[model samples]
Target: MSPLPGIVGALLVLGGCMVGLRLLQRRYHPHPELVRKLMHLCVGATALSFPLLFHDPQPVWWICGVAIAFMLALKYVSPLRALLGGVLDSVDRFSLGDVYFLAGVAVLFTVSGGGLTFTIPMLVLTFADALAALIGVGYGRLRYPAADGVKSLEGSVAFLTVAFVSAHVPLLLSGATGRAESLVIALLIGILVMLLEAISWQGLDNLFIPLGTFVVLNGHLDRPLELLLFHLAAAVTLTALVLLLRRRLGLEGSALLGAAFVAYLCLTLGGWPWLFAPAALLAGYALLAHRSRLPGDIHALVALTSPGLFWLLLAVYGRRPELYYPFTLSFAAQLACAAALALPADPDGRVRPGPLAARVGLAWALVFVPYAVLLGAGGLVPALHGLCVTAVAALLCLALRRARRLSFELQTTLAATASLFGLAPLGA
Candidate 1:
């Protein structure tokens, strides 16, 4: 089929699906999510046909653009709202899920040119997610916090089971991989995507799940079975370890899962030596949090670790060896700054600068010494450079500490900025 007819047909199918769902909703008045998931399944299933119907990506883009405009019209345009709003707007929570769904589908189709790589993510999104939601709403009893709302262990398990099937059946049917390799790949994708969904806020899951699935699948598609098994083991082991320390860490369930995802990314992409700083920070913070009852959540974790995550990406993805030290130092500075704040305050609830400075020095030494040793082993010596950077971070953190209102944010920013020290020509 040519692009024009394909675009028209695609739009017609999407419109028909929406209008059909609206009629069912008006007549039957089923649960909003049931109707929503029905729409999700229909649209996703229709999307699977794009690889065949249109040979080029232009038509897919056109279809997605039109659909997004129509979806927005349903939300805001009064006439369209009266006609089409019943199906989508029935839910109470705020969501741009429909919009994100269209966008993700378009991007995935374009990038993978619509093949097995595209098929699995779409299936996971279309089937696994829809089933998980319906099952979660009906049968889920063991609940915990997720993004803006709560999710059930039952729901997550459902998602994992369906995602595994979605990933496995395709690989097995295509005969692209052996059974053992297929099994390992499916398990890894299931665990990772489930965690992605668990931590997604708003309608971003529609965006993240497919893209994340593509990354995991494409990155490991050709690896040996041994590496695949190792990856699978690492994901499971990290998840288990985090859950075991959930209480001591003082992070919510979703936050803990987020931590596991970040840790896995670091370990797999950056290697064992790269894992030290974050692990040390987490361990020390977990100890202090348990002692002082300090609570940290997903938002806090993002704030503190985003910079280090950036540096890690640069070192690995951009092939910049110099940035590795910056990546490691960012975490060290983060730990040092955090530790300084954990000091015992005076009876009046004020922290003296002398004790604060002493605390910062002690904390930096504790975190950096081990990390520096690892860097030396890895053939990068930034020891003196790291010390100077950390001292500057501690001083800036001390200066920002008196701000009282924005202390944590200020200190975190300062610590991240210390990464500049690592940018100084490596050997110099």
Candidate 2:
């Protein structure tokens, strides 16, 4: 068989398999909405795979245009009304598949060179997105809402696992890297993609998953140490801002501020080192504040800002050696001050302790100390860093159980944060 025939055969097989899957879904599930989603996936996968087989962009464009026209016509026609209803409902129902498909296409187009550089990322997105949804929907008990309140833990795990496995397949098949190296790359990509998915709202994963995969595959970290320091700075700064704002603005506003800060940091400094900090803090605070309604909103502030304290310390001392000693002493002093403020002793007292406050403080401390230590150790033993984070997060969840009321906000936050830690090592 000629090379051309082989390529065509592969495409045919893939297309056939997808179509078969759609038929099965239609027959077994009989859910019009799900069937419509599968159809969209079919159309997209067909268009994308067309380019690879023909090696001509025109055929792919033509196919997409035709498909789009067909969809548009179906939108108006009465005979196709049943299909349209399904399509409309499916579109309304949020899933990450479209985003993954788009990302795969982007990676295919942007990476110039053939081979696995482009293909691996696309495969990762496809596999991860599909698997995450499958797992989350089928077996996921722990659900957390994304900014859009639509995402869940089951979906995230499916995404992470699929992405990892997808990336691993290409690495193994290409024979370009060792098992250990392939494992590391898979872990890194999986963790990074999962992080992006967790924080995304309202189908924004469409933008993030592709961008994140591109960044990781590109290996854009020229100065690992400096970039890491910048991430720490941004994380800390955002954490502080979230803490300060949660009381004044409330949950949505606090989250918005934190997100804006992260965007600014990524734009100026590059990467999202601070992504988890604000997410954890604001969510946790919102949970506690809603349940307890403690006065002065100090508990909310503490919960929101606690994650930052660790990032600040790591940035000043761990990331930047020049500022280490002075910053270390200053951080020690600050902790003492915070402790003193929370204590029952000041005569012209401003700070007052609440039941939730102490637990939040402890939880914050537990997460922070291990994160800092793991991050510090990451420079030498990357795997160990991942392990430390996982361990600490598990312990944090156990610790949170002691608190009287786990607000939806805090429960979601803790679950998401724990998910972050749980995912980190898999990608690493």
Candidate 3:
């Protein structure tokens, strides 16, 4: 009838599930997977039903708070660990799956206040990912390696297919007769979510998949065709790069896919003139990998850092030339320099500073030369500022190469980010 009663009822439901899990642990002992999935199903179902059942967010927030607290207690307090028994036996010792699960639900619950943003992504995770797990475990034959372990190609296909259908079918049926935009958004979101899961370190896909889906819906739903074309370009670039990488190393399919995705985003999303750097880096690495005969692995720090800067730019300034220019240009220079330093010179992963400068110079010329012509001499100061900042970042990366807390990856990320701020004045 009121918020108080609704809170009570929701808590009771949560407590009931906990007690049920505890009883299952005692009775079944080793059937922890069943208990785990049962909890997952109940949690998701409860969250999805919240906005429908209650009229306000107070009860929903309160329930999520309790769930979060319970998960934290289970993790830190020794006795609570017995609740899940062995369902998490295969997970890493430091795995945050439980916490992330509750967090995902809480986030989606809040997003549900706005409508389909929550409903579609939750269904995709609860239905698609789960189906993929079931199918992959029993029938999956063609497999690839992951941070957690090997996953089946068939299983991933299942995930993508289910996610696609769950995410888009409602749009088509929801009286959007003249507009195909929603379908495009669904495809972009589904593929991105699927790839993000494939490369998710440890088990963090729980967080990324849900959150990423929300971003696509919130940011690009109105511009579905543009988003679709952007992602398609990403797919095309990623595919072409994979073919080139094949001639060099026996890299995993996911790695190739992620690289392509990153390459395309870096090259396509920002300013047209600024993209040449990512393209050059992609070409250089593809060639180097082939020539050097070394195995290629997509480092998370590098992969995340490259795209992350782009996201930061978009989030902060979108496509505004004045602000976006400095950030994008500095990012390009940082990566170009880093690529020079990090490029495969030999089998030992050593840097050839002389060659590094040459490569960086070439990449810079390809990017800024065209930029300067288009914008006239006005682009000169910003271009110089960007180069100086990147050179400085290159040195920082070298100095911090052995820092225990700041890995080369972390240093580059920080340096690249800082360069944007440092050079923003020039663009402004």
Candidate 4:
């Protein structure tokens, strides 16, 4: 009665087909090397599926743990040769989709309480990746690469189609009907997943794809009008800021100012707790703007900002369903500001500080400060604390410009001290 048996059986059948194909390629087709490689891939996939079939504790653990150990061993040993024959490249050379597949299975086991709706979207990534590769290699012609010339439009379309269809499977199984709704949801999810894959360079989409699918599927988007307006306003403001900065100030100054503006907006919006990201943006500008430095300072700023800010925004507004739109708007505004400041501009532009600073300050005012006021008056003292915290952060940043090697201990102390004052006694 358990779906686990059926799932495992499906995986095994797929793997067996792959193995059979490899055998045919080796015996009749005479492509021994390709056959060996395919065989290894099939073996790995089949071994991974074993846990899905037998849902006992030991078998599941052995399937996962042993499979991982086997992969690791293959990285050192010639796994392809061991499985079939002939030396093959390291497993690292292959996309780590197997890991994602395993992770999805783990997620399914852990969150089975949420029903099939929860586990269904994850399959989209697996199906999409394989389907895209298959289609692209066979029929790809139209290419579209963001930076490197490795991506193609054919691949994108294939990925989107497969992911979209795969995303609908669980929904259909769970009783979602009406051909129109299913098609629309599938299309939306597919597009989003493809987009994430296209932009992701560091293979982060393995995690982001499934997670994003889950959010979009479960989360409500009731304020489309507000979201659209907020995005438009943010985009316009960012464009104006970039154009003004480029015309009035040199690229370097604009970069610094733009980074600062974005940082301020993020802090004000309550997304990030510190100003370090903005500072890093500034430092990046400093390096690119100056010919003398390697921009080691950017790392320092990133290190300071990442931890404190990473969870701040999500913690503050993630649960407040009503405030989601406003928070999304503020977050979008910050990103827009950052992108605007990062645009490439002509070198002949003059550097003017006055207008640029004012624009940055204006953005902070329109987006973050007003939101803070709304949150503060609503008895959210943390908003007030956030402002005080950011002010101290600003001062610390000014200090860091003079001394980059400020110790981690000192930084922690400073952050703690600022936090204490920021959260000063309510009456005080």
Number of the predicted model whose lDDT against the real structure is largest: 1
In candidate 1, position 205 carries an lDDT of: 89
Error at 284, model 2, angstroms = 15
Residue lDDT tens for model 1, 1-428: 35787788888888899989999998989999999989989889989999888777788888889989988999999998998897877887889988999999999998888899999999999999899999999999999887688889999999999999999999999987899999999999999999998888778889988999999999989999999998999999999888887787777767888888988998899888777777767786775423533245666778778898998898888887567778877877877666666766565546677776665665566666776676565533576667767777865665565555445677778888887677773742
Q: Is candidate 1 or candidate 4 better by TM-score?
A: 1
**RMSDs, each prediction?**
2.2, 14.1, 4.5, 9.6
lDDT of each: 0.82, 0.46, 0.62, 0.45
Q: Whose TM-score is higher: candidate 3's or candidate 4's?
A: 3
| Candidate 3 ranges with C-alpha deviation above 4 Å | 18-35, 83-93, 112-114, 176-179, 224-255, 263-274, 287-320, 328-357, 373-376, 384-407, 410-428
**After best superposition, candidate 1 residue 144: deviation in angstroms?**
1.0
Per-residue CA lDDT of model 3 for 286-371, tens digit only, reads 44323433234546524434544554456446545455455445445545545554555455444677876776665566555655
lDDT of 4 by residue, 1-428 (tens): 56555545654564455557646755677433344345434533453444445454344444445444544554456655466322222222344434444454445434433344444454665557655655665677875433212456687788888787776765666665445455556655675556556544324455556666665555312324343344334433543554354422233221322333345335445533233334333333333323322123223333334433443465455643233222323232332233223333235332234443443344334334544554465534444444434444434533543355445445434543443342242332
Counting clashing residue pairs in each candidate, in order, gives 0, 9, 1, 5
Order of all candidates by lDDT, from best down to worst? 1, 3, 2, 4
TM-score for each candidate, following the candidate numbering: 0.94, 0.48, 0.78, 0.53
CA shift of 6, model 4, Å: 9.5
